[model samples]
Target: MARAVVRAVSASPTAQAGGQVEEDPAHRTAAGLLASHPWHTTPLGVPGGWDPALRATIELIMGSPVAMSLAYGDAYTLIYNDAFATILGGKHPAAFGRPAADVFEEAWATPGVGDVVDRVYRTGEPFREAETAVALVRSPAGEPEQAVFTRGCSVVRDSQGRTIGVLTVATETTEATSRLQSLGELTGALAGAVTLDDVARVALRYGLSAFDVDHMTFGVDDASGWRVVRRVRGELLDEADERLPPLWRRLPLDSPSPLAKAAGSGTAAFTEDGTPLREVAADRHDQRQRAMAAIPLSTHSLRGALTFGRRHAHLWLPAERAQLTAAADLIGQAAERARRFETQHGTAQLLQRSMLPEHLPNLDRFRVAARYDPGIDGSAAGGDFYDAFVLPEGRLAIVLGDVAGHDMHAAALMGQVRAALRALALANPDPVVVLDGLDKLVGMLGTGTRSHELFVTVAYGLLDQRDGGLTIASAGHPAPLIRHASAEGQLATVGYLDVPTGTPLGLGGAHRAMTTALSPGDTILLFSDGVIERRRRELDDGLAALAKSVAEAVSGDPRNLCALATSAVAGATEDDVAVLAVEYASTPSRSATMNVPPEPTMPGRVRQWMKVQLSAWDVPEAVIGAAVLCTSELTTNALLHAGTAARVHIDLTPERLLVSVQDSGTRGTVTRAHTDTLSSRGRGLGLIEELSDAWGTDPTVRGSTVWFEILLSEDRENP
Candidate 1:
């Protein structure tokens, strides 16, 4: 049975490479490559001797008709059936039994394919890309072409529950796809990837390098209907017209127009005059139009067609017709790849954001806002992460760090580092101690690691909510910038914090902290290297430019300030960028704090204390009642879910009353108090939501902070 699965991949009768027929040596099928090849020299080492799990998986995919590939073992050696060999372009035959990395050399560098494959293998997380543009044959016989593949991946685990490899099932959807993404511009990397219109623009740019046409149109189908996109060559149309997509017209499926007929019938047609083409594109196909050609694409699966028009009457040679088909093929490939690249890149951003803090604490004392912009090559998650949370006392912990990578591993490591920092900060609120512990943990994480680029730079600071005092520490990170303001809230001096620098975490170094007092209305800014570091620009110059930009344009608003800081390098995706701003208020608010254990009586006890405190502070009678009721629900939530000591804090001002309850986690344990832990706890949150003016649960690194606020406005305070 094992050998039966092995024989399924034996050699094909004929093999083709680069539009040339190949001889017997490399003319074997997948099965032949598996059977006759020297497996001992490769990573798989004795292919047919694989475990039952590997063999079973192979047998499962072999009987199927989809284009699928199997990457086995740690090295992810390749194995695919005949269906997949069609899309391999020039990579096949030679790619039959090679490591995925070695086979898809250029492809391995991009996202959606190589990064996703590596991530799936390492973390056992499956990934699916819609239209991953794979450059299979860049210049097949001097005719540059592309193949678009949409593939799904899943982990192949052994019986022992250990992940061994990744199984990929792919479908070539280039012809059927419509939403074409930009595949980098002809000038290379303009506005990121270029659009379907851009591909036509490229083809038309060099006059198709051979085929001459005054105008070109590529017709595609989507949910709306079949649509023909037209492009007039060489500034024949005004700039405004060229910038728009199509004429916003939908061609009916059964229409008699040439474009419609070609798409519907899946056939290619040519007209010597503009009479037939004038029905749909009368504006572009004027009387002077010499000829038009409509060629159906892979209509059997993907419904699309290509139309080209010539300005002068000319003979239509067979090679010229072939070039039109080739151009259409290139466009179809771009459309598929563009869609695939977008979906894959979007998912990577989602994964990166998922690891970040879901909600920043709405602390009344601090005005905070954070901004994160992914790099241009967003196929992988950038390791830059920022976190802001409430510590033991009223101290607000603000941390922003950059891990040394732009992949899943880096993003995962960033999450781990952030989690560890939060835990250490919760146990000990001292800035220096928290970083010292992180430095050690980061060093420990580096031991026995394959990557030599295991460096981490972090900026951690603690701001006392009770006062404006702040202590900041750094580990090979840039110094945080602080913007001061005068009593009148006017613009003031902005400069870097005097933090004592140390080596990036993982490399041995001692850490230190520097203390500074922020006057009321002042703000501190923390950012990743992406903000000040521009491509082909000096570091000192960037710093100087940022300072001047802040002084001239930035106001006291934290949101506005952070926005400008992140956009300093504007549209440049050289690296992952992040900026966090925290502002200190001028006025003080009265506050009271108490700790509640997991005991059943803690809720009632907390309510009584909250009531007495609110009444003593002269809070409105109606507001007092609502505050006490909401406090009880929050306290009950902690008592039921956290199972540890919790802190209840109440802050009162003339404007509104803010109450927060945070669970003090079990030392060294990560506890997430999800809202649906139990039916009663869920109802408890429900009750809080109903009574409080506005309530929210902050997702902390460890445990949770459930907060509610009651505005002191009339009619609202009483409720």
Candidate 2:
């Protein structure tokens, strides 16, 4: 049988009759080890007498460059190339001729390696794993450490197609895999940052965690010099001993420091000694850093540097330096973007403020307050605006409007629209008529500008002090919210005034005005769509929230109401918000009325009647003097211009005293005359204008009324 087996082995293509063929030269060391091994004392006989399959497999293993090994027979005896010997760490020489189970006893117990080999041998199958962790005794002291490896195992078969051994090819991947994962996390953290401070916080946190550094500092180049903006130290440092510097520090730009050099040259610099940085340290005694590296960061808007320190005198590897450089670049780009955004935001705020009304006009019958909040970024001007001004005939005009876009063009268009609306309101007191004129003007404006498709939504209203009635006209605008006390005197009862709205301005349409009677202690709110618009929410749901908030704050002041409405809704939308609130006072105004004949002495009679009323009202002498002069001038003009009997009316409030003179004559214009030294007839209107705080005229159904106001001092006595 031995002779027959030998003849069969000799007849095989891979074997000779007396011994195995010479091994390939590519794996000389492995071939030499197997040739000198004591295989006869173990599972297999001498190498020359081995089975043809085993001999062929050994020859292939000896010729490969990868870390490959073959475990044959039931005992799983190990045979490997010289390349694989390096993977065994300290056990290389002794494990060369031993069984894989004995050489890697601790690793054999792990499922990814030893179990995979056993299964492949038993089932005649193949298995592969990438970045698999195996606990192996790689440390010099025989201690096990978790090492990652990309491993492949296959069942080796004999010429008769019988499974004989398991073949494995492995490449250690512990260092490279860790590096890739750390870089991925760092990139993700930097991508979400939105501001300079956010960038600093995220970069420092991730850098410290990923690099395991003792300390880190970030510096950026500005017009003045390079400045340190952020710093962090290892968690192991003593809290009492680690005294950080102030939040910011200026470094000499032309100095020999690593940060300055790195930023100036746009390259990385390193130093094993941190004595240079320690020289300028706020707490010199805490200079425990030994290894330091300054990496450059550059972006379109900024150039900066990042410094990393280690407590031990360890040299930074090339891979580590490359990773640090990459992380710094991401941080620099993000920070530059944030800086540019902030600059734009500040400019937009300034432009928007300039476009909107700075102070609402103080009126006799209404308390007005307004607020405007831009979008989250605040980097673009929005088209929302509000205005409140006193008009003729004891009426106050309040306007809230929004243009179609958010940009500089929209803001500019808003200013033009607001100015047009004010000019139109002065000519036509009716809200609907004023809106019609505004629509035509806005249409004309759009046709001449690049924003021809832009439109404006407006809620314009007029409040009559005579009867506390409110007349509102909407041009594709949200209805005003009304809050008042209930019949039982409970405050904060709220309701919406829904009226038919016309097409927005710039799209010509006839606007209809709606009238509502307002009682004392009533409040009205007008707002842009942003006030009730929210992300992923129904418009009605947002409106409900707005209504609930308004009802809760109805009893508060108009300023507080505007604040509440804005704060409640501004955070929920990216659009701009504008809110206007008006609260009607409860007390009726005090007044005195008299009729004057169209006589040359009418001015004297009007002054005497005003004096009696002033005395009864306990008006201040200074304000009374001014009021009498204004009344004399206004009544005299009404008589001279209208040629009709003048009806004089005086109304007093805590803030001002108003006088009105009505004549049953055709409406006439009032102009401030540039009176020469010899002129007498033209000086009266100019004198009235000079003596009053504010004055204007309004035409009535049968006549015209000229009105003037004198601001009362706080010391004036009130009835």
Candidate 3:
């Protein structure tokens, strides 16, 4: 066992109460404090009469660099080096010569410090503590922060070999402990990353914060070659540059490149100046950015590099190097995990798509458009699905649903559920009956297979084109949206078709059908929860956003509406998104015109109006193509030149289709044509004449008229 510090020094005990004693000049300040105190009234009277061993021990410890504190002569009087005064904080000068117990009256309750001191003094035993947390007034503001210390205690003795007091040596460990915690957090963040990209993102983010470095880079080998992500002062670089994956033009790492050297040898590389990497520098402006260090990310199957740098020159401390090493190891492990997940998910996704419908029914009465987008992890599969098909009696059936998983089981379950729903719908056209059967099937599957995640949310809709009747049912799914618009340029309206939301599949609950009649150009949209579920926003907000996007699109054509609705939001799709849109077009339209407002939103509103008019008329899709385009051109011209509201008139007959744009402008050609993509007033009316069978301009009663006509095709088509 360790014993208290004892320095050999010759000192004879002073017999007189007021006799002189030897002292070191360099340490006189501390010695003076001892001398200035009223020792005459204390148990260990005047310094002159103090024991020789105590005097010699005090003299030796007072001038030492280490933080040491000791009590002596049964009074357990306190004495310490200048370094130890900081540890005492507010309890220093007054505690100098008092008994340790009296000075540390409250602290005596705490273990490790006071108890260890007392035990050592009483039993002549030595003790050491690896780490002890003590609350101390460590700042000038008299506030306390947790301070950790490694302490060693031993009994102090005098010339007679009898115990005097306890000596304690303490070294602060707060900084080291904090570093350890930081490393733990980084490891956890890396452990949670789900993809190679996620791993790189977390690694760079943590490295930037933890190391406080000016530059960082993460490189990995993947299907996209040896790709690297670099950031300067935490700003990601080479994002807009197409040659980003490699980050440089060079095929292989150069001989002198810090990254190359470190990765090649599986060790760290350090450099003072960044000139060695100037050849592969992102640009000339950052050629001299200081180089700090580079470490390799290595595993048996994968190898890459993580490099860090600062703007100013600095050397890596041992502790800092060790921290970087640990961080690199975690990133490598995360990369490996990401690889496995991506591979497994890719296979699952292929299976998922194979199970979904390859095509929607080509119904002549209404247009159908469906789309399925897997979540942010593209390689991963989800349970979301969308399907549209014609029933035996000619009604169109649409289904959108989500299963509860990201694995193969969920995808397979989604396929089975979709097929089962279709089968039941063919037998019975009632939306309520079809969904009830699906609910029972799911409940049985969960019980039979003992699957933890067999829950499903589904919405089913059946539409009869004859009466524009649409019936919808839900099993805890988001309500479908119905968008209605007028061909006369009225504002399009979109709202949820409030269907009774019952318990999710596997949980038996009452399912009810809501019947609603669609207007001439109404579209019903069915979508999975992924379309409305978001990480940063509430489900209500996402629903509102979807409704707003649908309202703006308002294209009676299902395809256009589907495209716009899916493109409405930002960010990666974190869940599977499935959408099915079916527009009602039972009534045949003959003639219609939509008012063109003179505003920035005019272009989009005009498109929706024309789409609504054509769908209401059940106009052939092939015939409506360039006609819509050229009509938009004429309206924009009238709005630009006449500077007044314009009318887009669509007149269809058995033999031909005619469209005219009229506005209150005196000129035959209200506006000059432009060569811009948005305003296809295309060079002149000459381009219009070439596209249509014939075109001409005439003076109307109020202003002017630009008209075009095309021979209708023999075969009718649907979009």
Candidate 4:
């Protein structure tokens, strides 16, 4: 008991006149009397509702010694005793029957009261006890202190319940008593805090130390009532006096202690020491704390209480009690923040997993490893990718390219580019033909208008197991670096960078593509600009660096070359880089250069050659007549224009049957319909146009290769 007393004293500020609420007892009583004279009365002003007799009765009652006040209006009047007028200090007797704002100008002008008055007037509903504190005058020697009040006001209604005028009442509470009650309840609720235990502790300590409480604790609620979760007190309560009594104990929810009331009712309480201590297990020694307050922490999932035990009966003040309420709010916010963090983190992880690749293809004679690295900044998913697949021909086609930008839209475009590239490659193995087909697929270019600049740089090739080599072509993309194992167990460069070919797949023009062959024990590395090139370095410099790296890595084993290159560029490359390499074990043994010897004869010469080559390539006799006519027209056009040297060449593979006519001069386009005119002598080009499926020209530095192609039959048969 002594220890609890000491604790309470230690927590509380020294009692003085200038505490949170200052008492001016001598002036307080006089102020009330001076404002209560009959001269302060004013007559009721509304029509039949304001009866003279009733007004007199009301005035008599108002003048009595009651704590409440009343009023009526159009012209707002004061129908109250001196107690009411004393609340409006320095007001004259004539202030009655005046507007509320005029009489209590200083108070009504405050922002808080203005908002309250607006609600009352607009809703026509009572505005109950609005709390406020004010220090009207400064002290001569010490800090001025607040005088606290709780006000309730409403409209008075007629028989029909229609609002006729306003009525008001004000109540003054013991500031210390109210604050102690509020603090106890706040801490009681905070005791059961889970995520906010730290916040709860801070509130409890502040309540006990700053509010002069003898013993204070936050406690968790259970069926048994409140269990002390945290407690702070002075030496008395801390003592080990078995005979005296235990100061702290868990009480049943139904017990008449403040903690039990707070937990069961989920409400706050203020009680005096004199209240009967029914069902309390504490003895007189333990019950020495004369004042008590408990506030429930019902703001979160857990239930708890802030319980206060004070040695000095009236330790809590209004300002300290408000502080406890604020502390409880902080604890609730912390708990909510923790919950949100966990939920969001889980969602982010799920989204990332859904976007990653599910499986990678297995290739023969080669070990392949692919890596996708996202940008480190706040960028989302990107558009860089590498893909490889087998063509109908035995050769493997590989590709790597970037969409125009980064983001979901760019990733989507990357997919479109990849799918289109694969389809075109399979349809026609020639890299230039595949890209030209893509332009047609995208709906940009047509035979009539051939100037659309829509383009993407790509490098594609067919890996030939028959020759142990790759026939590769490029469309404005970086050349693949070729590395081969030398006889000395060292690596060396194998091929030069293929020049930009056939104006990237999308652009339409009369352009030619070049092919390079790879031999046995060689690796061809295809990559995007992200690899090899740094911002400060030109493409040639970047390519040189890549060649050096590949030559060294390919020396020992081809299987780990991919992993090695990935690590090398991972730090050096800032953007997405994709690398795909194909190496063969044995080299092919033959080389053939296809060249068309100059043709001299006109229409007849074309007819004979087309028949021989088409038969050699096993073109069916069923289409032999059509093939002969197509060759006749193309060769005739070449003969008429060049007139010196023109020839025809034919090649057949499982994918396509291609025909090319070499001529000496750079000539204009051939329109077969005009050539087939009634009086026209040139029926050759017209016959070729009607017979072939599709045809175009490859404009070369020396001359153009006028060519066309036909898709092979299902069995690739001559029949």
Task: Write the residue-wise lDDT of candidate 4 on 1-719 in tens digits.
Answer: 11222223223332111123233442233232222222223344222224222332232223333233444545455444455656555453435445665655545656556456556655766565446775432222434345577655555443223344444545466444334333323322222222233344445556666566666765555445554433436533312121111122345566666666676677877655643233462444345666677777654445666766766556455665555544444333333322333244334322332332333344444323344443322134455667767667556666666544445654555666777777777677786677666656543532334534334566766666566555666666776766765654345655555645555545554334556565556666676677766666676676666666666652422324444455544235556555666655442211112333333334565566667666765677746566566666666555444333565665443334556676765222222222232112234444555556555553322344566555455533455
TM-score of each: 0.48, 0.51, 0.46, 0.33
Best by TM-score: 2
Model 4 earns a TM-score of 0.33
Q: In order, what lDDT does every prediction score?
A: 0.66, 0.70, 0.66, 0.49
Superposed by TM-score, candidate 3 places the C-alpha of residue 482 at a distance from the truth, in angstroms, of 2.2
Worst 10 residues of 3 by lDDT: 1-10
Which of candidates 2 and 3 reaches a greater TM-score? 2
Best by lDDT: 2
Candidate 3 lDDT by residue in tens digits, 1-719:
00011111112123224345554452234444454445555676655445534554454355444466777656678877676777777676667768877776655667765677677778876666667886665434566556788666666565335566666666685445444444444543443465665677678777888788877878765433345666667343332222111111122544455666676678878776645467666553247567678889876667778888877787788878876886787677667657766677556666777777766776556767676766644656779988888888888888889898877788888988998998898888798888889989998999889875688999988888688788888999989998986443356888998899987887888899898888767888888877777678778887888888888752455655665567566544567777889877644436776777555457667867877777677677766766777777777666645556778877664445678787875222221221122343234355566667656554333446677776555553533
Please estimate how well model 3 matches the true structure, expressed as its whole-model Cα lDDT.
Answer: 0.66
Q: Tens-digit lDDT track for model 2 on 341-398? A: 5578667877887877766866656767777878645678889999988887668899
* Worst 10 contiguous positions by lDDT, candidate 4: 238-247
Better of 1 and 3 by TM-score: 1
Q: In what order do the candidates fall by TM-score, top score first?
A: 2, 1, 3, 4
TM-score of 3: 0.46
TM-score, cand. 1 vs. native = 0.48
